[model samples]
Target: MKRKKTLNMMSEEDFLFTFQHGDYKFVFEYDTPDEFREYLSELKDTVKELEAEKSYKRVQQIFKKEEQIEGEIKKGERPANKENFTFYDLETKFIVGKKKLEKVSASTYKAYEATFTKLKDFFKYERIENLNIEDFERFRDYLSTQVVNKTVNNHMAYVKMFVKWGNDRKLYPENNVQGVENLADSSPEIPHVNYTDKEIRNILEFEEFEQCYKDTFLIATRTGMRVNEICNIKNDDIKQDEETNIYYFDIKKSKTNAGVRQVPIHKDILERVLEIDFPLFPEKTDNASQKAILRQLYRVVKQGEGKFFHTFRGTFMNRCLKNYPRDLPIIQEIVGHEKEDKIKLSVDTYAKGYQLSLKKEILDSVSYY
Candidate 1:
């Protein structure tokens, strides 16, 4: 009797096995040498059975079995059919597991929840595995029609983040949407118009302007703090310098490391802030407060598309640069901006920062009156 070859095999590092059955070929991966040997032995036994039966149908069955085993070993803990895993499932895991683990603030959590809601609406119960780069690009196009370019970028950023998170866990093949670029506005960019000194005075003196909004605007204009930073200010954040006795905002919580610095409260709003018992705009959400401020601002001044609450920060920076052109580092520190110049970088590395009194002087120079 002539000897028959059971199976043709090639093994690499005892981790990968390649098998050829006539013209059909298959590959399998195993975690361990023992696993590879065990799988190979089982496959050999099946081949023997099929060959002895001399059934062509049984020979085709061998290839099917080989593919099934290959997929099973490669997937490991992942489900056999990832098609059932929806985008919503991955989102829920991220919200419940990763977000909770990070202990993000209420406002940040709300923002993430809002973004996830938009993603869910766009994806619409689609399998996460089925999502590809084209789908994300289409979602970006959909967002562009509905919101501004800036907002579309925000939504797309969240989508990329969520998709990458799912991919890390082997929920999908890969982060296929990672290559999707942010949408660029087709319209010409409108330069941000800083609120003029006269406009600043008009807004503050506006009869209909709410006290809280005024307070928030005042802080942003004087200290060059962002809208969210102004809104999140707490009573404890206000501190008095021991030597200078000048009151300043000790901003420990900020969006960036550069933002986490002390800024002097200009004397203009000092008494008003003290009288209000600090945190002048306490418990107000940044978004709602910003919209309310804009509505009141438009009532007093002519509505300019570029003029908004954030313009105050830019206006403040403009004043700082105009008044203290030589003190660029001081102005950068006051505005929580990362030092860009070599001189500023050296100063930042060696010196802690300019004194509170110096910072107060710089802020006092930023007067609209």
Candidate 2:
């Protein structure tokens, strides 16, 4: 038997051995000959176990476990002893810490909360330390069954974040989730469907649609705001520009800095909004309001398979581009899109954006009738 082969001898006491078994390769380091012999004995035992099990996954787990133990020993930290600690326990602590710290926005925090809820449901009572790459693969399989590939990727991203958080805190071994990868989002990429003027009219005039849904859809189409931004509008958010006396939506709090802008209300919806006093939709959760809008939209529009509440935004942009193709900067400002082109970037750096009156003109021009 090839008993001991030293690949690199850094010193008389230090030894680094590169060992390869079939398709698997591992590097082991020891401070002394005695330690090297001890590790060799452990390696032999692992080989015997692998031979008995003949499972490639078990082989990975065993080697990864050894590496984790070695890593902890090198760092002068005790190896993770989380036999009683569970995925639920770590997730609870992580979520509570996130909430207490207020590190993320409410919407983002809600997404994290939802992801962890699914993780808890799937991984119930599973030990955090025992979770290896295979377990995460299993979790991904479970997520695929529950949601579309796109949503599964989102959940997997959150899971990866959670595992990384645990590793950073030394709560678990880093190798536990080392090989997990998100499933490919093979779902067909549906092109953004811009609602035509006729389709828009049908949705707004449908007698079955609730008044709030109509208002929400109208606001979205007119202002080009995201569903969350539209739902978050308040009475105070409606402001009149002092210089031009142009009334606009003062979107102060937004998901992005570019989203925080004065979106001039279109002339078509202005009078109706003023009649109802600013907040067009009734006070309700953003998610609920968004769902209501979608439900109403689907009921009225026959060609709404890929279309959503956000499609109204696409329609707004399409109309703007159709009318003012040269004034891309103004359109981008109105829709709260970041100026990415060199010309737009230069304009953003030097200019405070188009005047509210100019924005109003552009928005008023976007007519469905």
Candidate 3:
């Protein structure tokens, strides 16, 4: 139905008409007959001449979102929240993150798995993206009940690592839980110290241990190698010098890439390395190697000491500092710590790696006398 009003006896107003735009009714009142006649003439021209009814009420509302997006690109405008990850929870993070990230070790991954499992049991909310500081704090309280202070602290560390990972990718933007601090370690500090020259001799000469232990322990003390690194050493890792008649152990792989360095063997320990054909500790795990090192440490250095195989590293560093305090790069190269050559650009990038002669000099300086 159409509604039209005629201005037969009206004062000064012209004729008007009403149209329906769906539920909304719009009435277009004419200002004057001349204007109305002009608009009707245009409408008639469109219908008769063009054969198209491109009128206002018949227009389709086309969205310009794609066009707007194209315009933004042309104007150098970037979009926000375009990351594909919805959010990674504890389980997914543990599985995927662990596999993808090489920095995290197997032991660290295990701890993360245990920590996340406990947290999952404690909390109802699944996705970490939705969690806030209060959620973590409450989780901390729950951890305090179930584990020792040290273990609870470890749980907190795991949570912080996960949160940091999420924040880096803008996943857990609100989970900046800074208050989850570690508890103070109340246990008595065990005395980890450098083994005296005589104690080193005693450990080397200990009758209870086999020749293999003496061979490996001597290598560890001289080269400042971790017990794990020592255990993993293969026969192929040993390389000899053509000029100096000096032999070297190439630590081709280790805990960190930084740990991969060639160490010149001491004259005193070189004879023992010659006889080694198998892996230093073929079937031994890190835990087993640690237990053996601790047992020997207790015997040689006496009980209640914090020192293990790692004490050799500190001992080597101490000797280096005493003799050549400023030579940090050398000591760091010998051990698995970060080295200077890795960061600084050299004049000759091709010759940037340390030469065997320079390596020999450094090892000789730090040698046990």
Candidate 4:
């Protein structure tokens, strides 16, 4: 037989080479120096083959996962095929919801975002079906430690909304979101009082308000307009009747469809609007209204947390509800409260929108005077 050349490949010269990449480290040694060159060449080729195999497997996994996602979506079903359904997917759903919704305020949207973030962090991205009420309880318990009971309630309500929103679309099964009950009302213990005419005038003339937010605040106090509603107002939203010479703001964005009605501007605020020349509040952000405008207003008036931009809204409603002719439903329409019966459907849908003259009359009933 010819000499066999397949030497059992242990070299005696002890050549050692180290390889390192990221968190992995390795060393290889050859005991035979004369044979090291050929052995090292073979080792390099083997390592390259193993690395190529690993990369191919990874690419295959990515493609397979994408195909699975596409199939689930086409079937109009949640991606339950995956081992872990992502909370990232759920957050995407939340954003879709915010966009589909009409006239959601910036502040409310921020709350939704924050609430979802906390849910994701606490649960660490659980699959929709794998999630249960106990998981919600864990999140709730965690929030209770981190926030006050009132803030906790606000967050929990949005959490329930998230789960309910998903449940409605079959993203989560029914009753999976039920156990997160709201904590008791922990609103600041202050007597609810309507913003008085005296207080309203005091803040309007209070000088500091003059420098930044006099017009918008005056509009809120008079019209009971929410800050978000006013901040988003555009020049086109301000309208006049060629016939009546009446001026009003058509509120296209609000808490409800009832909020889509118009408010005839009072002379005081309208004069200020005329002078400013464009969208009344230059500051567009929600914090500009809440933290910047209202924060200063709150301090100037010595008002507590109980008194806010919304309190002025209550005051407008209080004055109108207490004084305006309730049988006409004028105040209700102006303040954007839903009509209880279909008997008044004409007022809601007639002539481009609610009759401008009628709304003007209702708005005239509400003023800083």
Candidate 5:
């Protein structure tokens, strides 16, 4: 019998060569000139076998991984599954994990949570794969049905914030929802600035809410503070004993960081607050029954006002312009506003009577009479 060629054949010279067919590419190496020839012969046969096995794509993928590892090793980088990455998937992960949401106020997070919930409901299936501008448009339409133009604008703002936040984490492309604009009249309708002190007194003087009403109204009136801000106020926040004495409440939360303040406690309000027995809205024993009772009480107590809670808030700002420093910037500071310039401009536009009063004060002080 003829001697068989060794399968692990070696020779004196070593050489390297590359082989390619269509998109598939590979390297062929041999120890010597004879083995280099042998490798080319074997490579051709291997390609024919791969073609017969219908694995052209598999062969290309193997070559690609090899190339990827080579480049990664040179760069001192670990290989990752690039195939698994996408904009939406990465964004969801970032929003749920890396976005320091705990630092955000509970109320602010509540609003974000509401907007996020709506997104979840709208994009229940394959949210990552299927989200588009039209999806946002659909969300806009849905929100329009639920709220007014101003509120719809707010939802849009929140959504934009969410998208930008997602972008910061390399979650999605920046300005992905760039075309969505704010409402035409973005300076929200200033909440019908007509609710007054007398109206507030009249509502609170009614028997139903009278028990806690005076306490509630006094806090709102004296400080130009928000309703929820007052509601969240703990009994420990009260610090004075006399009706005219000055004290301070550590304002823990508000619309912005500027809202955090040590508000002076008008003692009249402090004394009234000290008298309340429990939470203003105590839990009723029955479920639906309690809500119905409160609704009736709301109607009986706040007849003319469209919203009971907001009526107090409007009253606070209105009183700020009326009795307190009507200087727009001063008013903004008293109310813990971040942007004094905008407040001054808006207050100036709707504050003709106030401006006139200031002019009168100046004229009177000049001793021109």
Candidate 6:
């Protein structure tokens, strides 16, 4: 029979009650009928709630703990450590933080990051600390086996940067890894300047590309814009002076703030700009669009077969050299260039006040030359 409070007031002395279960005990005291009943109900609920809470806490504690292997291996049971690690694994972390590891451009960091994967494969079994000058030299020699001097030089530079970063961070303390020297001494062939009048026609008439090339070429040749500078052009960048018949483009200096200068728009390019209905890049018309229109140009142009858009810039510069005042400061403004040199002077001379007139002159020269 379950125990309860006294049946009468005569038996009012408090009695202790104890209950036992596996790994748990409960004890309480009660004197009155109401007190004993309420205490009994409360104790039951408390015990169940505590058990549920303990189970929940145990589950949460397991998830918070890091996993550790506990099983006995038949033959390969050993604690995992850095002893057997490859150089490539450590290099990954370094490359991700490579820019922060050393202040470098995104493209430079990306190029450096690619070298680590190749290095990892080259030094597959060797640990990072075990690498020395010989290992890197051997890898360099392997790279030299297939690539040309320029390509080899590019890879060598990236690897050297990696080594410099590793050394600075003391990643490989045991090994004093002096990076391999560039062995290839051959200079790359410098192609002769062939910016002829006829070449300009070929570049302009080469319609086997996209509207981007056409638009960009028009801007580059007529306005003498740099590759990246032209690429960065926005619709909002154009500023016009109808009364003076002069057009200006608000531009940021790509090379330096000092390089910033107002460009006078050529009339031919101005007309072309007016003709285009929508954003220059239709698919992603937004300013932050990543698509390079050049790559898709071939599909757009129905006439010409194999011409690149950049050749227009070359033609434009050559035209500038031929027509404008070669030593004019206007050349720097037109070309969006930082350094003023002989080439710029030549361009300035040929392309002075390069507007619709100059563009027509270039086309006529191309036609007649």
**In candidate 5, what residue range of length 10 has the lowest lDDT sum?**
360-369
Expressed as tens digits, the lDDT of each residue in 1-369 for candidate 5 is: 122244335343324587687678878666557887888788889889878667777888878965755554333222242223333343344344433444454455567767767766666544332457676777787878787778888878987777765556443344455577665654434334445545556655666555555565556656667655666676666554254344556677765666765565543455665666644545422233234434644754544435555455455556555544445454554556654556645654465222323322321221101
Model 6, span 17-68: residue lDDT tens = 7877557788877765788799889888988888898999998776543121
- List clashing residue pairs in candidate 2: none
- CA lDDT of each prediction against the hidden true structure: 0.76, 0.76, 0.66, 0.70, 0.55, 0.56
lDDT comparing candidate 1 with the true structure? 0.76
Which 10 consecutive residues of model 2 have the lowest summed lDDT?
1-10
Worst 10 residues of 1 by lDDT: 1-10
| Candidate 5 wrongly placed segments (more than 4 Å) | 1-107, 125-131, 138-154, 181-191, 240-245, 277-297, 300-308, 324-331, 339-369
TM-score of 6: 0.52
lDDT of 1 by residue, 248-327 (tens): 88988777778889999898889877766555555656566556666866786666467776787789999998998998
Choose 2 or 4, whichever is better by TM-score.
4
lDDT of 3 at 33: 69
Q: lDDT per residue, candidate 3, 1-369, as tens digits?
A: 122244444544345655443344545567666887777675556445333334432443223543544454333222233232222243454455466556654556677778777876876455565567777788887888877787788888877877776677555456556666677766677777887777677777788777667777788778888877787778888888787766887887677877877788866667778888757556676557667766766766656666667888888778766777776676677776775654423512455556667666666665554
Compared with the true structure, the alpha-carbon lDDT of candidate 6 equals 0.56
Q: Which candidate has the highest TM-score of all? A: 4
Model 1 clash pairs are: none
* Stretches of candidate 4 exceeding 4 Å from the true structure: 1-83, 185-189, 343-346, 349-354, 367-369
TM-scores for every candidate against the unseen true structure: 0.68, 0.68, 0.66, 0.71, 0.53, 0.52
Q: How far off is residue 102 in model 5, in Å?
A: 4.3
Kindly give the number of clashing pairs for every candidate. Answer: 0, 0, 0, 7, 1, 14
Candidates 2 and 3, the one with greater lDDT: 2
Q: By TM-score, is 2 or 3 better?
A: 2
Scored against the true structure, residue 56 in model 1 reaches a CA lDDT of: 72
Ranking by lDDT: 2, 1, 4, 3, 6, 5
